[model samples]
Target: MHLPPISLMLLQVLALHTLVFCCQASTFTDQTDKQALLEFQSNLSPNSRVSLASWNESFDLCNWTGVTCARKHKRVSGLNLSGMKLTGVISPSFLTSVSLSHNSFHGSIPPEVGKLFRLQHLNLSNNVLGGGIPLGLSNCSALLNNLEHEIPSELASLSSLVLLSLRRNALTGKLPASFGNLTSLERLDLAYNRMEGEIHEMLFLGGNAFKGQIPSSLANITSIREFDIAACDMTGSIPLSFGRLHNLEILGFSYNSLGSYSSRDLDFLGSLNNCTQLQHLGVGYNRLGGKMPHAISNLPNRLTYLFLGGNFISGSIPHDIGNLESLQTFKVEQSLLTGELPTSLGMLSRLGRLQLQSNMMSGEIPPSLGNLSMIAELLFYLLYPGLDYNMLHGSIPQELMEARSLVSLNVSYNNLTGDLPREVGKLENLIQLYVSHNQLSGHIPQTLGSCLSLEEISLNRNLFEGSIINIRDLRDLKLLDLSNNNLSGSIPGHLVNLSV
Candidate 1:
């Protein structure tokens, strides 16, 4: 009823042949993967406690220890050889190769493990290897692992590593000079270690105690995007070679003695014009000098914070500073800068804080400064303040007081000689005003009373000759100094009932 006898018999024979072929392929894969697992366990150096006794033909390959097989192909897809007193693991990928990263093993990386040509990713980070490793890999993380002694030059052979995070280790000795050979390296994090020498990258070596100048060789890595080496105790000038890094975005050199206060100390800043993507530049508190670079005006408009304060910088702020439209903070106090405030500063509509105090600047306060329309989102920020402790003269610009976002104003210790503008009342959030030691005259504006948030007022050493205005509405007033002035009135009634 089905088919002819010979035809049916041939069809059955073909079906049986296909079944045998499929079984043979499956058995071949299992034996190969089983042998690979056994090889994996045998390669682990020292007396590894990785309980891999079950990785045998007696057990199913899919059910072997730390071995994971795919649901359909049933091929060895992952291996988590952790808790072997070691620090490596594996994962799935194409080429069907395996990986090893982030585990709790405690042996030196065995040469046998590296011999596996099919291995893909290997991250043996955070292993408490109580003994010694054959070599400390320089281009990968031994982070928080207490790996000691000098990093040998032989470890630089791992040229394929992209991120080498060796932070928070006790690894001592000078950084190996052979590190420059690793051309594939991008980010080198050597922070909080005792490694010496000065190399940079995305470069989180901020807390180390290296004793040399930052090597100019770092500039060869033009692909760098962020380079931060702050507080590393490295003296000497920043290499001008750094300018070659056209892709630099965030450069931080703060809290280090990096400059000599020479006339050209800060020339590196101008050299950064090619780094069009730069956003945050913090070079404050170094011994850097030279005039504020005119190229600063040409800095990327994307620049947000520029902190060059607490240095030996001289000359004037760049007149084209307003070009940094995205600038939020401009701090250059405690420098040797002179000359008048540039009118272009007022064009920084996004500027929220300006610190130019303790300079030798002269001339009248630029009236254009009031044009700064500080963003209203912040609850506290010194808006266009800190023009104090200079040789500035002339009256407080009424325009300056018009910046409604100003929270604190300090023009004291200058040679200014004008009546405080009544527009000050427009600063409803004003908390403090210091206009002391000036030649300001005329009745203190009653509008000052409208600023109910006033907490401190230092109008002393001025020529103000009238009674204190009725600031009874200023419930937050804490300190009021009107001394050395020619005022002939009693203390304001606002303070009369207070327990000062």
Candidate 2:
């Protein structure tokens, strides 16, 4: 065992060098991960705008564009190739975060993606990816997509999932009840899909072919604010439980077959009274019929827009509709409505647009309507208010001219007997005036010439006496029809010369 001190020192130095070499060898290059990334790059078509030329065997995987590695293990941790115009099937990699959104990437997302057990975020949105989402992605927290397949129920296992958007895709199949397991989810948009089944939360599934009844389970999503399932093939009355959504603000169920022509069909309107925050309600173009429910007037005062047109709804519009202090637009045209227009509508000081044409409403235009100083657009023509259609008898209300902001006035095809209001010229902003096909008798209002903004004037088929006095002054008139009136005298020479 006896040895020179220098020999012993040399052995110690050798031992130290061995340990250093072992440590360096243990920190080997992640060749498997690197090769996987290279394979993904190879699958995409070559794009002049997006070159992954730096992804090669010569360069460290961490140094590749769109690649990031963990600090300690130096393993690929994230891959963000968003908006790169990369086109190809997505290849799986052991990444924690993967975002290839807004690209031209097409083809099915490989099931191999599910192998990323550590994946926290995955976004393939705005791509043309087709095929089912793999169940293996249950570990992800944020799952966004542009996928065309059934939403896998396995997604319910992602307890940490918060945001899921599969909009503008051809996704089919029903929403799985297991989705209730995602307690942390805040926003879910599956619009423009072919998915069926009930919805929950702030759901937006418009422009989809979703069928079946809107589930009453939706009441459980008390936190929901916006629910839009319009343009779907849903049937059955709107769930009365919807009233429980006190926070709901916008509700759209238009263009769906949700009800039949019965009083019970609109029973849901009573439930909505609890939704104090409700502002917009659209249920037009359905099979809904029955008297306009008085419960509609009980809707939230914050309601600003109400559309109930294109339905079989009968009876008079609820006079209490004027209670909607915030009402801005009210559309009830093309329905089986009867009775006269409600004069209380004048109370809607904020009213801007009103559509009540194509109904069985008779009687003279309400003079109270003139109180609508805020009215900017009005459509009540195509059926004379006092002519052949509804048997309305009265003079045209001069009060209407008080609405200085009025841009359009339509009251044609009625059986009214009176002269046109001379104050009609007071509507300085009037661009269109339709009072044709009536039984009115009198000279054309001379003051009508003051409406310089008039672009269209229809006064044909009326029992008017005297010549068209103001016809010569409407220089901006693009259309003028004053024929069939009992007027006498030669046409004004200036009127014939105008470019109408």
Cα RMSD for candidate 1? 12.6
Q: Deviation in angstroms for 440 in model 2?
A: 2.4
- Which residue pairs in model 2 clash with each other? 384-412, 384-413, 384-414, 386-414, 386-415, 386-416, 387-414, 387-415
Where does candidate 1 stray beyond 4 Å? 1-173, 176-186, 189-203, 374-384, 472-478, 493-500
Best by TM-score: 2
User: In order, what lDDT does every prediction score?
Assistant: 0.71, 0.75
**True-vs-predicted CA distance for residue 428, candidate 2, Å:** 3.7
Best by lDDT: 2
